[model samples]
Target: MSLQPPVYYIKSEYIETDTGNKVSRRATIAGPQNIILGGKTIISSGAIIRGDLRRTGPGHAVVISLGRYCLIGENCVVRPPYKTYRGTFNYYPMKVGDHVHIGAGSIVEAATIGSHRELIGDIYQSKFTIIKDCAKIADNTVLMPNSVVPALAHFAGAPGQFVEDLPESTQEMVEAETKSFYNRFQPLES
Candidate 1:
């Protein structure tokens, strides 16, 4: 399969960083300093990244870390997972590996999402969920808390369950698709 058609956004609505990150002005990103985008990532319009929900400590902390060529689709909400430990509620960091895509309107509170994974549109990933590499969460799936998605699995349905194993070519396919998505996402011509 080939890349999708180009997605054009209004230039004034997005800020393209030197590292080729395209952040939409309409997106709500809390605590910018606490969030790290590795490069060539896209934060689409209406997406909300909660970097303010950080680990409770005395020192500086990174709340969210996203690797290269990732996409946070429109209206998605990404926040660090939190839990009570030692009688204290605390939020932990969220790490997303390279070439990952969180699809439109998805809500993610995952602790770690591995490389080349795709969380399809409208997915709800609960706290502390760990998604391994090359996994695909089907559209509208709802993952339970503390869920662990194995590598090369395809999960679907509410309280997501592994429905099938993905092909070995998933990694290459996902990488190419993510790269293509980034390349095609451009500002409208003046």
Candidate 2:
């Protein structure tokens, strides 16, 4: 299976990453393919991935790996491109773990945003903003680059700071709720 998105912009065509997989973008991708973007992965119309992917350099690549049932808000920019060097531009790969939710208009540029977190902001700009799982980011909060948010905390405001750590019990509740949601809608058995 090829994980490399085309270097150009594509519109309106449902794209399934694997070839010969019955689950076409228009059809249902099942089995091993069903596990990845095979089934529920939807790139809305006018959504462009790998726009002008640089063909050279070690890091001039865009890698987006979203776990099952992860929804990317419309008009959201995940891993936007940036200049890496004189002639070698690089595109940050958005590495989202399982069951994550990125608020609409929040820009996750080259960062490791953990699972089950809600990052709300007009422009969430950061490189390597490491937010642990089960975190809640308040609206319009600006998370500075290189910020590390521990798991199960509430964050708000510019350069978001930890307002509170979710008690272990609360964390367990969040995890349980999320697990239920994912398990219920997980791609039906092959």
Candidate 3:
């Protein structure tokens, strides 16, 4: 497989893509196993991605599987346990859909974050934090695990409360903000 910068690792594994993707110098991806990243994905600097996704029977860990065209911010720590058991193993693999934007320093694991989920700040995501598509999680927001954030909902605050239904005006504003932020530091295409 062809890597953009061609950085070195002690022991790393990846799938051979027909087309190469550009991985920024600022990004830090590490793991003991394979780091599977899809095509056209931008992994910025300071982003910590762990590749160990499987469980040792009863022992748990966070496995992050992101879809295509995802933008994961800098300094983000996404670690969530996939299985839990009170005598029996609770198997729940973390899954993120396409076109999702996860902000910096956000800890995401457990459940399924649907497509187009916009999350910001520090999320103390639990084993069952299920967010639907097109949901907006404000900066510094924390989503308690097992709680569901409805689609098109506008959430804000430290512990993340539903401010109100996400209006079109608010959506427009968020879109604009997102566009501007990414534009400022757009990844270089190889």
Candidate 4:
């Protein structure tokens, strides 16, 4: 008899999306708002997403948009930037691209992350990080605002910057890894 892959035992705290995304119940999405989820993204437990805040628009503007294959780690906060408008404070829209992974306890004020470094653990990521496609980050790296990371690379250190480019062979590997990570979390059958 053929064997099935062993089912991973995730805590009941996770809510799996129909499009293959896993959102931890403990994670704060702050519904009643416009937080877009691209596809196959994972928001780990304790993650806080401030979808309630955004700039004024046609009454249906989107804020904090996350792309496919993205991961938001535990206790991380994803919020849009805010500035004074007409003597009033307002937040702007933030967009995270595909195949991105942000580690735990990070504060995202920018619109993008991951040269594909997938910010894995606690990190200081600012609003100005420019990560190209297929980038990877080493643990404990702090990504400051206005920094740039090229594609197919690795990032590390405080105020984290793109430190090294991954070997070309790893490109396909990262793609596969992204798919695998998305598939790894499944809803427990009731």
Candidate 5:
């Protein structure tokens, strides 16, 4: 089947990406060529993805690969690693998995952010915020750019530092949350 988003959640119709993925019209996705959004993902209003600052390449090397069913909240900025090496400016790639929810105003500039992590903030401005699986970033915690956060941890700080590890061994909480939310809009058979 084609990688376009399913007709299920078309209720909130917004701007359709070139790949047929629905994104908020208010979202700012610069350089769509460098961004790869998996099917059924929701990018809310005011989100920004800087795909324009990529290095030259042969194939369509995606700078950001967001997996299916991922959610990017309002005002979030997802961009690749940017650095000026020897006066040469280039950006790295960023990969994200399913069921990952990034909240408002968060800036993600990491190489990868795993699944089941819910990062909530009012205005996340980071240069390199790397979040692992099953992690939760609390609200209003500004994360330093280029910081790596491990899995199953709960982080909080003015600049958002690692606070504590999650006691749960598995990702039951995340699984339940994603499944239930998705199942709600499923059309019932006649």
Candidate 6:
């Protein structure tokens, strides 16, 4: 059976960059200079990216770095994780690798989210969480602080835990899905 690509009829809500990054005008992006979007990433309406939360005592810091073909769904908040060290609190950088999809209404304060990871709707990823490559976080899941999700694992529940191992084809599947999603995201014809 052939699968159909999802279609979104977004009007003139998004601003497409030269590098193919589509960022919604309604999205609240703090400190655009401190955020690096690799390419072909989509930041939907109401998404908030807190790039102003930078590390202390740094000349120049990248608070949030997102790789190619990433999707930050509507109303999602992406913030860097912070911690205290030697009586000084500092925000750490958050890195999201290629083909990552963070669903709508999700709040992420993760240190690292590896390539080909999919986080379903309404999920909360706590500070210092590490989600490895090809991992999937189910809808409404909450990943506790400092949680580590192994590669190819499917995690779910309030305090997310490994539910099962994903198929070996997960990487390819995610890559194709993300690419297709990006391609199918279109501006509605007036």
Best by TM-score: 1
TM-score for all models, in order of appearance: 0.96, 0.60, 0.68, 0.79, 0.77, 0.95
lDDT (Cα atoms) of all candidates against the true structure: 0.93, 0.54, 0.62, 0.72, 0.72, 0.93
Model 6 gets an lDDT of 0.93
| Candidate 5 positional error at 17, Å | 7.6
Candidate 2: clashing pairs of residues: 23-28, 23-29
TM-score, cand. 2 vs. native: 0.60
lDDT of 2 by residue, 1-190 (tens): 4333322323224343442111223322222221234224434332223333433655444555665445444456665435556666555555666556555566676457676665554547577677788788887788777788888898888877779877666445544544443344223223
Over 16-113, each residue of candidate 5 has an lDDT whose tens digit, in order, gives: 55654558777898988777888767777788988877575556454788986677877888878777778876667888887777877777776778
Minimum summed lDDT over a 10-residue window in model 3 is located at 7-16
Comparing 1 and 5 on TM-score, the stronger one? 1
What's the best-to-worst order under lDDT?
1, 6, 5, 4, 3, 2
lDDT of 4 by residue, 49-135 (tens): 988875666574547788888878779998876667689766677777776778778777775654344666766666655666777
Shift of residue 66 alpha carbon in model 4, Å: 1.4
Lowest summed-lDDT stretch of 10 residues in model 1?
54-63
> Residue by residue across 1-190, what tens digits does model 1's lDDT show?
5547898898999999999999999999999988999999999999999988756677646469999999999999999999999998788899999999999999999999999999999999999999999999999899999999999999999979989999999999999999998999889965
Better of 1 and 4 by lDDT: 1
> Judged by lDDT against the true structure, how good is candidate 2?
0.54
Give lDDT tens digits, candidate 6, residues 1-190. 6867667756677788999999999999999999999999999889999998767776757569999999999999999998999998889889999999999999999999999999999999999999999999999999999999999999999989889999999999999999999988877854
Q: Report the Cα lDDT for candidate 1.
A: 0.93
> What TM-score does structure 5 among the candidates reach?
0.77
* Weakest ten-residue segment in model 2 by summed lDDT: 20-29
In model 4, where is the ten-residue run with the lowest total lDDT?
Answer: 1-10
- Can you give the lDDT of residue 16 in candidate 2? 38
